[model samples]
Target: MMDRRERKRPAAQPGSRRRTAALLLGSAVLLAAALSARPVPHEVVVQFGDDVSAREAANALASLGATVLWVNRSEGVWAVRMPDPGEAWRLYDRGAERVTDAKSYSST
Candidate 1:
């Protein structure tokens, strides 16, 4: 039996909030570290859609001063050299699909 004037008991311990905050901070740091562990790719491979012609894709890449390291015209795939990963957007604008990092490929 509880008194009407008695306050409700707190659901959580006083230290619980600090534990949650510390866990969140630790998780964030772990995620940031994990993401940073991967190497940044120096090049990317692009697969152009069927609607996009090989010549058109090639021209667009050339205009961007991007080197076409390797190309499989029949498959509509092009491995383009890009020093900056952010610059990969130029290829996307030209109708590229499955744009993936090709750091494993040799520039030669």
Candidate 2:
């Protein structure tokens, strides 16, 4: 008679391999969906200099291909969206006092 410890272990079932592949494929699909849902054309708040008027600032930013979402006249800030992250530097060059990422102060 063979001792229990001396017996060979059974081979892995074929179903387990299929289940693992399925799990990996599902994870990949979910990851792709998540990546597609991420935000694009990042939002930013551009605070204009004291010398710049709201209309002037808006026109300037629009000329740079920024989409103006909102304008805070009292605060002298314009909330705009740009495709490239580095576009904030251009806003500063255009007479923006400060340019901040809208995501930082957003509730959502």
Best by TM-score: 2
For each candidate in turn, give its C-alpha RMSD to the true structure in angstroms.
11.8, 10.4
Distance from true location, Cα of 85 in model 2, Å:
2.1
lDDT of 2 by residue, 2-108 (tens): 99999999999979999999999999999999998775788888888889887778777887788888877474888888877576788777788878898775423
Off by over 4 Å in 1: 1-41, 73-75, 104-108
Per-candidate local distance difference test:
0.79, 0.81
lDDT by residue (1-108, candidate 1, tens digit) is 779679786699879999999999999999999999775646788888899887898887777667788888485888887656777777778888667778664424
Quality of model 1 by C-alpha lDDT: 0.79
Candidate 2 deviant stretches above 4 angstroms? 1-39, 106-108
